[model samples]
Target: MDLTLGAVLRRGLLAGLAAGVAAALVALFVVEPVIRDALVVEEARAAAEPAGAHEEELVTRTTQVIGGMLAAVVVALCLAVVLAVVFAAVRHRLPGGTDFGRLGALAAYGFVTVALLPGVKYPANPPAVGDPDTVTTRTLQYFSLIAAAIAVTWLAFAVRNALRRRDWPAPRAVVVSTIAAVTGYVLLLVLWPANPDPIPADIASLLWRFRLASLAELAALWGTLGLTMGLLLTTRRTPATPATAAT
Candidate 1:
């Protein structure tokens, strides 16, 4: 039950390792297949177009798309490492057998990371698409948002056990994680130029990109959370076997 700096560091490192492995596996098996299928469909559509459209143009577009996807993947991996460390460190400061509380804290942390930050940065609009014809873009945007929400949820549960036992002040981990995530997001947005031709003309387009970025961030946080929780839960003491009745 002793919460020390060394314990926190050890837990964070272990969590980050586990999260990185899990995120990599998921990217290879699940996310890759889906991305590949989308690319194939896009290729087919491009192929069916009239001749003299310049196949090289299509190739260039495809390359850009792939590059963006890969960049997103790398970002996700990094996020996982960071989140794992943060969650592990926070959990280490809390008391033992506090899984439920840990989860609650994580969920709060996620909300702060995803919803609160964006709400602060951008104005809210009616959650509706401006153009019905841009369904593909809208769908991708929503998909990214859902993925982000799921990742946050996963992180919340991972830390639930640890949070239950701690007397740490409310919103500490959540606030810190949110600030870190937002700061990182702003830096990336500023340092990296915007796409010359962004899809969708209005709020929907912005939301879509926001969703994608959130998904990456959430993945990183959850990956770390999973690793830390797994370690704590597995290494904790187990109850002794019951005494045998007289034969």
Candidate 2:
């Protein structure tokens, strides 16, 4: 398609930034309120205890809206940059290079590695959930899972490449690699510590809703970015007809 690296990065980053904005909108309008409600419930339960410094000045509705939106944009921008780099890195590894199929696969890979796998190990919790003291520990666990997921993906690629070199059938190599990645992921899920903070049954519904919202938000971001990149690439690859070229 004669696309340069700079063009790819520029387009990918723009798409990602746009996707992040869209995701933040969903979070601000849909997810944050539910989380806020959940926090209220928590606050009532802890009303009697002397408020710790961390607990003081709970995230107000206004701050939630403003902060959530800003955070979403910033996070999306950063995430998009990284995803763009990853897309470039894996472009050659993908069959047929940077086609729509490759774009879709990259998006799916990003979602799985960045969101699903890590979330499975440490799903997003409501604001009021978890021990404040363990914030550092929990953060490490979550990021560690992310790193592990990336490692597992890299390992799958390595396995596939090794098998391919050994004259294994393409289909067989893919299957074996898929199985290896899944097995590694499952093991990570089991070995990792999930959210252990007990939630009452009543708040379960809210928590469930919040988690779903969180997933939807991220899915939306990746979906937008993927679709945008696909469109951009397709447009770029389109041939100019005689009439169009003359014009």
Clash pairs (backbone) in predicted model 2: none
- Residue 234 of model 1: what lDDT? 48
Best by TM-score: 2
- 70-152: candidate 2 lDDT, tens digit per residue: 88778877877776777677676664334576777777777888898876677777877778788888888889988988999
- lDDT per model vs. reference: 0.48, 0.78
Q: Backbone collision count in every prediction?
A: 22, 0
Give a tens-digit lDDT track for model 1, residues 187-207: 533443222333444345445
Q: Which stretches of candidate 2 lie over 4 Å from their true place?
A: 50-55, 58-60, 96-98, 166-169, 200-202, 237-247
| TM-score for predicted model 2 compared with the true structure | 0.85
lDDT of 2: 0.78
Each prediction's RMSD over C-alphas, in Å, is: 11.8, 4.2
